[model samples]
Target: MPLDQIPDEKEMSFLDHLEELRWHIIRSLIAIVVIAIAAFAMKDFVIGTVILGPSRTDFWTYQKLCQLADLIGTPALCIDSLTFELVSRKLSSQFMTHVSVSFVVGLVLGFPYLFWEIWRFIKPGLRPQERKASRGATFSVSVLFMMGVLFGYFMIAPISVRFFSTYQVDPSLQNLFDLSSYINTVTLIIFGCGILFQLPVIVYFLTKAGIVSSALMKAYRKHSIIVILILGAIVTPPDPFSQILIALPLMMLYQFSIVIAKRIEKREARQNKES
Candidate 1:
């Protein structure tokens, strides 16, 4: 519907607005549930191929790491084996895990459509300029989310699995990981990264709201680096190399957020001058 056809927020009561929001949320949930059901139908493939891929030495990430090690003359980076086996202790553990994983997959896959519904609900409340300013918000958010997911899967997840699976307190002790524990680690890492990758979008909104400014971000550059380093250490393996790897991209994102903030400031300044 066009902006002119849509009823203004002033025309609707609080209950009417709430009802509209409820329907949007309901639609989003329905999309997620439908996708989840479809994912559940392919539980075997999702669990075997995608979920367990990082634990295997023959996985793409491992292979690439090994190749990089060969080029650098460091065989230590070549992960030849993972020293853990995943086990289910309870009878219904596998079935429950399957359902949970399917739901998570559904949420990830249906995120774009879900956000589109949210945007539709919010669009009518925004002025024409605000709507125009956020023209590509949904697309940008979705792309960043997927990029983060892929980064976690290909870079962070494999390295973390390899490290945790191989690290041992005693040579005689064997690593026997629970199935739920493994899945939780993978999902958390992927989703965490996805959230982190929305830095630019978050900054845009904050800047537009006059809560955050480019000057503030620039002034806090050193402190931000420290925070990013801490975050990298928290997310990745407890090693300098792994921490550095995660920190680099995060720092880049911070810098990119600053640039985004600057653009928003300039745009708003121009609009103010015109008015």
Candidate 2:
């Protein structure tokens, strides 16, 4: 086996494998760069509409909450009036935050392509049946990640913002946030949510490997909820309302993972019985 020969589908030596992986990584980086450039160009929209969206009273989520409140006749559900000021103390803070947020936006937008590139590299190593078993994995993961990000941004982040901005130790004290701090907090929340949303996928694979089962998850349901609550508290501000907001969706995801694990277990049982 020589080191020079590698043409997509042919057997590759160690060096050839490294070369292939390098190319895949290069392509993925290029995609992320292109997306970052696009995001950088749309600076005003990205900063004004997205990064600061949750901090505003008239944001879409708040408006929807108001409407829901009116419908349910619960005037208290109408979320409004965040009192806070975002300030940048350092000279380059704003520029640095702009670049950082743009890069994050790029990654979020290009997540599917980035993951596809990675899966392309890994898929070749798996057997045909194994690959077939994970058919649509890229799509499912990307969609769930986006859904979680949206939920965090539109729901959890806003609630946290509202709570912290409104909470007061004294009437004279004001809530002032650093520009970087605010953006970083929101970005981390969304990212954390995206990772948390992979519960079902993780459960599926663990079930397939016989490392986890529906019964085990059911037995530890209370523990899982407590963990989810802790995770919510870690990602969100130290407020019960915000913690509850993030925890609710995770609780649902956990329950859904149990169902997924159950189905997979039953299918395996049937297959083994037939054999």
Give candidate 1's TM-score: 0.92
Question: How does each model score on TM-score?
Answer: 0.92, 0.92
Residue pairs of candidate 1 with colliding backbone atoms: none
Q: What is the C-alpha RMSD of each candidate to the true structure, in Å?
A: 2.2, 2.8
Would you list the C-alpha lDDT of every candidate in the order shown?
0.87, 0.87
lDDT of 2: 0.87
Please write out the lDDT profile of model 2 over residues 1-275, one tens digit for every residue: 21223344777678867877888788888998899989899998999988998888899999999999999999999986778998999999999998999899888888889898888878778777677768899998999999998988998889888887888999999899999999988998988888888888888888887899999999999999899999998888899988888889899999999999989888888989999
Whole-model lDDT, model 1: 0.87
Clashing pairs in 2: none
